[model samples]
Target chain A: MTDATPSALSPLAIDVRGARYVYPTGNVTALGGVDLQVKPGEIIGIIGQNGSGKTTLTKLLNGLLKPTAGTVIVDGVDTAKKSVQEMAPHVGYVFQNPNHQLFARTVQMELEFGPRNIGLSEEEIAVRVAEAVEFFGLQDYIEEHPYRVSFPIRKLVGIASIVAMRPPILILDEPSTGQDHNTTHVINGLMRRLRDQGTTVVCVSHDMPLLADVVERVIVMKSTEIIADASPREVFADKTLMARTNLQAPQVTEIALQTVVPLGGPVALTPAELAADIAMRTGRPAAARTDAVG
Target chain B: MSMQAALPVAMIPGNSIIHRINPIAKLVWVVGYVVLAFSTQNIVVLYSMALFALLLAPIAGITKPLLKGALILVPVGSSLLALQIIAPAVERPWTPVGEIGPLTLYGDGIYYGFVLLGRIVASLLLALVMVMTTHPSDLFTSLSKLKVPYTLNFMLAMTLQLIPVFQREVGIIMSAQKSRGMKGKGFSAVLPSFVPVFVGAIERVQQLSISLESRGFGSNGIKTSYRQVRGRPSDWVIGIVGALALGGLSAYSIWRGTWNISSDIVFSPLFVVVTFVISATLFFGVVLFAVFLSLKK
Candidate 1:
């Protein structure tokens, strides 16, 4: 839902009102008048082509980049009035490049860095570090240097490092970039788990299938503005919107739209849904159908 | 691509004696080499030192980078040598090998050129051995152990890590510029592309600062390190011995009134022999320790 119409009962986790960002150096407008809102625990995916202001938008939420116009209220605190360091406890950001965020010598230290920075007690820091290490499957390399790890593992360490901070809202920029299928699957599972635990997850990604599978809402951006914000199913169903944004629906969704639509069957966002739609149209027994698709 | 391939002299993982030697020990060795290079100008002594440093490369598992650095330095060293030999800064009583315009090449200048080449080769090899064996973190940890300021240590580590990143960005910027029909060659041509590259670097730095702050970099609490640098008894022994040897050489040079004896003092053959023996022993001792540790392990 747009930030302008959030109900009073459930306060918005992220509220942006006519938020606009311009690069100071070139006077280039990156975000041209954006308005959006994210409810607490909502898993939202932001998708756009290069230079569509997806990253710049995420930076605004964390106070890394201030909005040139309007306001960004994260967890009821106006981001413009707070320094990035002050907003860190509320909005944890995981940068795309693990190298840029990773400065500690070891994985354990990296995970503890954020928690310790927020002035958590030693006991609390230990609990967070243990949880992150276990969740990210980093037990084996806890003592090893972060840079010595593989690229996929490094990205996981970067995510886990932010996760350990226990910020109510987590923002991941390009989490699936350069990841293999299994790694992306693992990341998707992690994001879902975080959402289930009542942490709001805002992920910016180029992977349509991943966004469709994990995020409940998908926001399509084009030319520095949000063009569509709807449930993944509704967003993927809009052919004109997808074309204008230079995005493609997930393969399964595309197939369902192409083949299943002719048969008057419902659209599927995932392969499993497509399979089930096909089975139902063919009159297969529900018990005989596989439960593999999401 | 592997990270090692991207770096100039990537640390090769191994249990070799050289790797086991404390980073502080390696640092001390580097300091000693610098001191020795500056203390004496005898061609025989300097050449022996360079030869000895090069000889340690294989034992440390860094011969590849060592050879690469040496090959690159050859042309540089030759040019310096040629300059010195062709135009001696000051005339000497030695015989002139050749004359060009108003300048005469002297035998002393040739000897001095060899000494200069030895300094270059020895310094390069010594620094190469240290970096090729030790992790950047370990090096910084050693610096911290020496009581270097934390901020300085952090800056050093970041600088080392950013080298390859900056190189990659430069390549990306050049390609982007070329695709836009921008044409140039060398420094003048590439100068315009630096603006975008610099802008990218500034952005990266801002991101890095935020990342650091989120992790409590400037917090008021005592920060603990997960990777502790352990200085063993062997490290202390090497560090102390290397320090003493370097100190003794400095003292002896000062005592003999030959601390800066480049052209004026008569070349003392005895002092040259003594310097060779001491420096060789010290250098060989480090190599032997690496061998001993590797075999023991």
Candidate 2:
């Protein structure tokens, strides 16, 4: 598919268009005529205040809910037309609660649950379970009741539950919620790991700083529609978009934007990126990482 | 406590004698104990048994919060006591305030109500001890140990596991509703919260279950486990206690006059009320434990 063609025919992870939803009881529309496209192997962050249709949109992506109007395509398959089981091998969804999806009596049962569902043989299930358990560092709690352990460990079980399926795209809704610093770091590390494996990561979270660190592009939703979709640095750079969508720039980004006056000009939103640029102007530091953001 | 709230974690780490015992064992023990308690109108034996059961609270590591869960039955427990004491005769019953209509039928109604009420308390306290001491996972293992189908065991495990998830989702949906001006006047306001929580939970279940299916939950194959349950010495001790408790009850009941001329209450408002309250407590306890563990950070 060409760049000009519709995302449905292409290799995009998520392709949504004109999606509108009004609940059976409510007059207000939860989602109204939304359109978006996210490419494969990309990390996209969804940021919005409460009631901005973030969760609703994710539900559409996973086929958990059918749209009142429009269609959502994940990996070119129409989500609305298929059941979650049919769409599951390509797209994995993690709910906010780690406990809900956990069905096994023990942690090992939790991980094996997904692969077995997707028609993998016994040997294949075993291999995937072993690899995922080791990868997520869930070796110790594999024998305990998931509910008997710490909160982060349960969250890990939830993630491992999804990861065992080995989907091409992973959608984490509010993953950082209720997580501590160490847990967040572990999640951050997991995201990088997933990215290296070429799985598209779509995360919905209110943690602006954390999302900024992991996500390349962010879609800011406000009141049932897309308000801003841009690179994290570029989107955070725009003050007008931030105010309109009720998305606050990271404290550090705001600090840099207000304090730095490089070449007697206003500062950039992502100071870390701008800092390296400034240093490059003077003399590029050999130690600085210069990965591109799109 | 609110219906939707989950209990805190490790408040009951699920490692007690009562917890290790089988649920069937526990259930049978309570039934048997009540029969023993009523073998005679011997208040001494009944009170002593109550005291013994109370001792189990400590041995089972049941918390003050858990005992507080029992406070839910104070009204029913007290009312049942009052009814047993004040009732005229099983052959012909009458109420003090004839117009009030609160006093129930004559015949076997009050007698059965009293017996059932006592049984409920005894059974519930036993259940509480089991839950406080045993992890739901262990309970599941015990079920599988008893040769229950994997399907039934899986459903039970899913229900146990998803309890906290639904509970927290209640909070999330409540907040989301509040933020969206979903506060309706009177009972409708509850519907807004219910809709979100209900719809959210159902949605999550669908999503998660689908994810679970992909993981091979129902296949006819031996699956691996993250946790192991063994028949330790503690389990044997629990088995002994559970067995002896019921056996003694059966013996005592046979010797009692009341056991033969049986008439148990089938339904009462208070009985319904009592059940509603107890089930609610158990539900909250499960969910709360889940939330506490999930949100530990």
iRMSD for each candidate structure, in the order shown: 16.7, 13.4
Candidate 2 lDDT score at position A193: 83
Scoring each candidate complex against the real one, what DockQ results? 0.02, 0.03
lDDT at residue A52 of model 2 (Cα atoms): 92
Question: lDDT of candidate 1 vs native?
Answer: 0.75
**For residues B112-202, what per-residue lDDT tens digits would candidate 2 score against the true structure?**
4445455556556655665566677666766676777777888877877777777766655543322222232356346445644665567
Please give me the total number of clashing residue pairs in predicted model 1.
1
RMSD versus native structure for model 2: 18.3
Lowest summed lDDT over 10 consecutive residues: which window, candidate 2 chain A?
A: A1-10
lDDT against the true structure, per candidate, is: 0.75, 0.67
> Tens digit of lDDT per residue, candidate 2, span A1-294?
111222445567788888887764425688898998988778999999898999888878876566889988887788777666666776778877765454456889767766765677899889888988998999999899766779898898878777777877888988888999778878987987887787889999999878877888999999989888888878877889989877788886776667554344334444465666566666866354453322
Q: Write one digit per residue (lDDT tens) for candidate 1, span B50-168.
A: 78788888898778767875665645665655566555455656655545467555545555666777888888888888888888888887777677877788998899889878877
Local error of candidate 2 at B158, Å? Answer: 25
